[model samples]
Target chain A: MRRFATLALALLALGAGPRSGFETMTPELQAMQRDDFANPGMLWVAEGEALFQRQGCTGCHTPAQMVGVAARYPVFDAGRDGPIDLAGRIAQCREQRQGAAPLPTESPEALALAAYVANQSRGLPLAPDPDPRLDPARRQGEALFRERRGQLNLSCAQCHDDNAGRRLAGSAIPEGHANGYPLYRLEWQGLGSLRRRLRSCMVGVRSEPFPPDAPEYLALEAYLAMRARGLVVETPAIRP
Target chain B: MRAACAALLLWAAPVLAQPAAFQVVGDTIPASLTGTPGDAARGRAIVTTRQRGLCLLCHSGPFPEEPFQGDLAPSLAGAGARLTKGQLRLRLVDGRRLNPATLMPAYYSTEGLVRVGRAWQGRTVLSAEEIEDVVAFLVTLQE
Candidate 1:
């Protein structure tokens, strides 16, 4: 009987195309995401704009120049032998170009910059760099997504794929897309990185998570970007 | 050897279920860990509690008071009608023996688990008596 239910849900998933987590949120949340002034993440965007001027970023490039950069990220970095997301690129630029220290993951400064940069790309479609080099990392990310781990022995695909629209208690499981990240999660009551979100999930299943900035996270983000291709960016997206 | 250990422990130890200390035979354990029975009332509390059993996180049961119940796996509404007491016992102990890809956790075993949260390490999700109590309550869930 359980097999039959799984099979039915699988069939239902087949009929549904890739959907965003935004579509799963309540009406109140949707309204909050729609109104820029009401969205708490805009606060970070404002802070980041100030930091850009104070840190001399505005001297090198205007705010308009950074537009759409977030849409084509998790790029293959030949030097690192891995992919680097938009947030990583920011830190790299600060270190290599600006001669500054690296920002810790999900630090207030890091999230602020990520929100500011990503905010520019809002409404732009995710177009992951299709470099031939990224193929290996993308495949690795795909494998990791399907592989079962933790004491629960559940894979990411099991819930996100098989039961995309089903309720896991009170909340509906979104398709696990990566379009709206660096967004505010009410549960966290603050902004967070996608890696932070993924780690929470790993721990949720009683699994050990990779260290911060692990290649596995880069690979997964790259894979998710590829998977969520054409989906419009919703940086600083509000989530429940 | 395992059976001898089970026999020796049944006589020597007061607490029968000692965290991954039960022996398996075929698809079932075939005997109660305590050599007696468990409290169904206590078992119901464990199943309903969010922090302990976490059963409602995936399996909805006959509890009407709990407004939030998961639909991830099969419903436990008629678990007693669907599975025997021994079958249910095996599942609560570790469903991986039946299906390696199962999302269900081994409520009583701690071996082979990687990166268990610090607070949850070195202990089972439930004690032997708790398992028996849960089993007792489930068997009563004939509907």
Candidate 2:
């Protein structure tokens, strides 16, 4: 790890001329996910399962229905005028139907429930089933992805897709896949939702991160989940 | 009056064109360096205690004094000799300044400081003096 940091530092020194944005990884970040699951993040999933059972989520979204459910998230919801990710759907269920308070989007309770529910379909293929009926939501999500919002004037594609394998600052840009969601970020000290992850990125780019249950985030999650179609879901994965 | 206006413009221009609020010179270390032994004992306290650095939640160190720290960050057993004071300062300041995509938020950069949500807003998580102290403790880990 020390050697890796040295190599990265040397690279930074050589490239110290001019830069547009910050780097994302160093040896410190690389080691973040190596010892995952041992983190307190799993407790959220545990608690979420307890909450789910307590709330009788299986009564509506049964285990059989959920077998391939995680893979099909971020679908267009005609009701919301955007693709509603699983977290949004969960919050909706709690608020409207269950007569319960909405869970904080990035809070431990929300992350846990999302993990537990998403984990039920882990290893399932990502299969976003977008319908022509859902076109409006898809379009909204796509538009949001391309629109520059932050003070830094960056879009999601600027790093994730435009230069997928290229190194920015210090860390390499990933393929922009949502296959592993409900991920435990060592930086966050616990598990968080795909929505939370999206919100975090917004803040990173200096854009206004949406409110905990904001529709824009839900739409974005829908789009992201659709993009990961065919990839197997890996909930609660470790991220830097 | 004309000269006064020109001076005001000069100062205003520099302040206005100060580029981004944060400029990250990532890992810009001097070629020549010195070696020193760090007090792992003190580093342990800073990392483990929230009152001090509270770094244990996000990083793991080689502090034998404390048990049960997370490995979210690389071990700092030999960090003293590996990085310079300035380099460490950048990491402590806005670590994300080094990596735009970093999950590690700047411990110091208040650019995204949230007043409504944050218990401490409009302030860096740690002061420069505290960062220096933490760096000093890390630099002592060469032993």
Candidate 3:
């Protein structure tokens, strides 16, 4: 019975869910995220709103139509044979539906447009669909998250899971959830995507980063979205 | 004939003293490398700097003068007394071999890594000399 109790306790520890990075921010940074007018990320949302109409997205979908849509992204697209995030979906619409060229990943327009779309879902809980097809991708992402690589020999779990809230260098380590992506980072001084952040983390570990739309990144995105399923979307949020 | 033999022995002495390439035996490295001795002062410089070894980023030490020492990993205040030189060398070479999930970077290895930037590919995080230097410095932290 003692052995059984120990096993149960270990399982409980393993199941502990992740926390939002917002909780780890300084009070001043939290305040920056609260006030939309003062938030620099709002600038990208505003730019994205303009792009929505100029790019003819307004013809089929208004801002209200996009509400709560961002919360269900990184869904498996059978046509594409894999998962695609909101950013990829936007690029697809531009190419297939609007007849416009696909926006380059990480471009200002891409950041702005994604920010705008993500903004419509602000305050909604992330609810990625549990498509069975996504299970394989999710598994792969879980593997990637735990796999140690790079010169540092560190996995995402090493910092975000096992040592969350610990300090690395001078900065406090967060759980690394993707709830508030396309966030305005004080360091970047501009809007950035979750993929951009992931790329930076890859570089931090001295690992080569996969390209913007690589399957590995997509897989990682799929897992992050699933991991933050219950967290409220805080799109265009501020981060230090 | 005796004088010639003495001269030959003298010439071979320095070459024989050269440090051999590192070899891992299980988790611990053998103590005493065969190369030029490391400078503790140079090792201290590497540990404290962010652009180099950046050891202070995770591991704290007795350097009260350094304002931003981190507190993530174990403190290095008395590492010299706690671990032998061979153990320190192994940790610096590839810590993951000892604990498969260590967050410490392999300061002097170039294998089984992914996505290494173009400018840094095929290069270890630290040269063998740097590793020896760091080991020398770490072994001095007796208190």
Candidate 4:
């Protein structure tokens, strides 16, 4: 742990250089993350693949076309009135392109499909589009990351930026990057979305988490993706 | 009339606990919230526990048993020799008045906070008694 912290501190000293959560995991967990057959998140990826073929998604695009698409998400779309995250874009496709019923925020199908799409981009660095219109949303996301709003009065920056690589009780505090979406969390005992992780963090600080579908979450996601530029995507990543 | 009403209310609820109004005098609160000193043993319990106080989450202290103390704040070793009891009180109550961007939570305040969880609304993170207990334990950590 000390050696890991030294490396983490070294990275921080280099000015918030992006570090994958995989780099912070214990060797045992890291091995589990590496093994697709051993990782439980692969089960969801399998389900997502089945759903992709069954739902006629192959008509317009193949699974191969989705490679690196997750990295550029939460992009500004004038037709959508603002920025749309990867999941939002997927939901929009279901409605507008597929002419299917909207996927409920309460279901597992959305998460499954997201996992499948993001899995294709695994090992690729995050590179959100540098559109001028994304500036305001990204700035708002940055502010939210730094602003103290919870009962604990701690911001995301405080723990992640100032105190990253430190121990919080028995757990290691990673840099709070969103590079690992639909990751398998040991605490949750299942695969969960990036939004679920953010809401969990908000609740951990005793703050009122934004609603499940809040636009604020997209802004935060946009900011996190920007912050994690060059860090490899680790869909179905394992975390303790 | 308001004073008479206040007197009447106090008389009506003689056992009711009133909120202690702590005065900030130059980076310190020159009085205890409970009027008497807190039990150091009880204070120590709160500081080291995982749930209560959560001091070890960000502040490493002299508790050798707790190996994974945090590194966000300065070490708690010799805290008694460094800051006065009153000074510690103010920091626990609201350190933002001193350092606006401090990561330390205002354990004894609930004012002006945004989007506090429904279960924690209108409640301070720690009660006045808990604050005094923590301060009591902190003062015992001498060089």
Candidate 5:
């Protein structure tokens, strides 16, 4: 009986906290993520760097100036009146500064730019802006994360929070951190944004996914950034 | 007195039967799922196919033909000896009542959900007949 109690307590402790998806990956996958040449996600980062030059973004801001910029995204934008992620910010820059039409969300160019920008902040700890003004959106995101929905009657927390490290259909359930975006997934065989991954989760749970730039997604991103407070960025990550 | 009690229980069975919809009672479902007996063959097809039940996404079972099987949920190798038919029905109907945070999708029941896709609104993952079919197949797993 005493042994059983101790085991139960240990299990409870494991279930109570958050963990990086990196920790859950196999050694080979970890090595793949660590090596820039071998990581499939690097293809997108390379394309994004090229796109950045072609778009004339380098004329004003050098790559060095953009480094660590992604660590502070999903920040409150007064003009947009909500939190905007790096993808949204890239779209904003295209329209406002470059006098170019905003690229469609998840378009190759948008994904590339987002990937390039995120890669700049690679290795830096995620530190989304903590302004008090963004609290309401963050709270909404928290609620969305916990709210049960879809035909499954499940919340994101159901798997990511309670079942992190547990297997789900042969895939390990990570703590649902957004430290990686513009990540390359083996399942997708290409790069995808945070919203794209979120939409996939929604569909997996048989729920309706919001549009790419929906406020709900932004709120969710804000919440994820806050949740993954200290985790290092893993842009262009490889995952099964 | 014992005979009278037995008679009363039989007489009250139908009256107590929850109308079509499932009614969860604690950890076990105290009632049988359907009026008709389940067909194991039909149940097997539903459980194995991705278009219908998609049970293989999170469950591994005795089906050797299917190439990929999940290890997320417990294997259904000896499920017959493990749980009663009524209990299986409860899990199929709404597993949330058993473990509120379970990832198993409710094959039936449509209530208190949000952001449901337009194409799937008001539709349970599996129909009542399909639920019975799957349950029938699961109850046959003795190995």
Candidate 6:
């Protein structure tokens, strides 16, 4: 029954179809197609590349090691015993390897850098590598995904999975993957980080958002990252 | 003796002509803004100019000359008669005091601002003098 429900939901998402009319007519859409190479976010990506170079990111994540690397992220970390999404992984690197202070969860630089790195795997299938080390984290993430909260009394799956394409307050909920983050949100008036987007979901769920770098968030990210494996990356993609 | 008499005359001559200080207390009004009426020309300038009051940052108003103002706040054209002067004072003194969710910065309340090097620090954007100026101007905005 559960499998039948899942199949039905997936079909509904694909059938509900793309946003009609003004979303295509919007200036943002026009800009995305016409000038992606020179877009502000892309420019931020270049800056991130420079930061990575200057910060010696090539040491552990060598150039060859990074090809198709983003597709495997939000993987389970044995140390964390849960899912660790790309953002969580990056935070760990900054803490353990770079010896730099944790970048602010919502800062422009962090979002831009994350988007830049993620964009490397654009159009590639998400393929999170499984390891026994990640089972605990994935379980934690799955639990959080199923938990209900907010005045709406809804779970993450209620809208993102069950009603993926259904309209809620004039906006359609997408597949709810972290793939395209840190995408730009027009509502935020700037680029938003993945953790920030996660925080937004928590608020939508009416749950008091946990702080960025929280173990629960990391675990949830890990799970979504794995689920999104085989999906293409679309960093800095625009969302309502 | 002559100087003293002149000072007394100046103090007593025209109490009615001066603008009164508008006062408010946390979403409630202990006194109405019955004091010095504001100047419309000045209030218009305050709302329109970036260096002055800059009310357009949060509130929308009919500035036919400038259309690129903030969209977060409601339009404020003809705000005077629409809102009681006391209500206006409360809104200005501290919008958060009225609606905790408002992004409208408290123009008057200044208890614990940690950031430094910003204008309107330790004070409302519009001082008592400017508040009256804006109120007086808004009162004239009625259609």
B6-112 per-residue lDDT for model 1 (tens digits) = 22122211222347456788888778867778888998987887556678777898999987777888999889899888889999988888887777888777777
Question: What order do candidates take by lDDT, descending?
Answer: 4, 1, 3, 5, 6, 2
Task: After superposing candidate 2 on the true structure, give the runs of residues whose Cα lies further than 4 Å from its correct spot.
Answer: A1-41, B1-143
Please list all clashing residue pairs in model 5, or write none if there are none. Answer: none
If both were scored by TM-score, which would come out higher, candidate 5 or candidate 6?
5
The candidate 6 chain A region of ten consecutive residues with least summed lDDT is A16-25
Candidate 5's C-alpha lDDT? 0.76
> Compared with the true structure, what per-residue lDDT tens digits does model 2 show for residues A22-138?
123344433443334554555766887898888878677765666677788776666765566777778888998889887766666777778888877876877786565555555
lDDT of 5 by residue, B25-84 (tens): 767666656667678899999887754676766688888897656666898888877988
Write model 1 residue lDDT over A35-102, tens digit each, in one string: 99999989998998888888888878888988888889988887787788888888888999999988
Docking class for candidate 1: acceptable
- Which candidate, 2 or 4, has the higher lDDT? 4
lDDT of 3: 0.78
Of candidate 2 chain B, the 10-residue stretch with the lowest lDDT total is B7-16
Which runs in model 1 stand beyond 4 Å of their true positions? A1-15, B1-18, B111-114
TM-score of 5: 0.82
Residue A52 lDDT, candidate 6, scale 0-100: 73
Interface RMSD of each: 12.5, 18.5, 17.7, 14.4, 16.3, 23.1
Could you give the CAPRI-style class of model 2? incorrect
lDDT of 5 by residue, A77-188 (tens): 9997778888888888888999998888798888888899889999999887978778888889888898888755678887787667765544567888888888887767
Q: Give fnat, all candidates.
A: 0.46, 0.00, 0.53, 0.55, 0.56, 0.00
> Candidate 4: lDDT of A73?
79
Per-residue C-alpha lDDT of model 6 across residues A16-79, encoded as one tens digit per residue: 4223222333586647633677345676677777867777787677655565767887665668
Candidate 5 reaches a DockQ of: 0.27
Note the B-chain TM-score for every model: 0.84, 0.64, 0.81, 0.84, 0.80, 0.68
| lDDT: worst 10-residue window of model 1 chain B | B4-13
lDDT string, candidate 3, A1-240, tens digits: 243245346646889544788988889989889899888898999999999999999889988999999999888898988898899999999999989877878899998999999999999999987787987788788789988866566788888877878877667778888988899877777888998888777766766778655799888888888777778899888877
Candidate 3, DockQ to 2 decimals?
A: 0.25
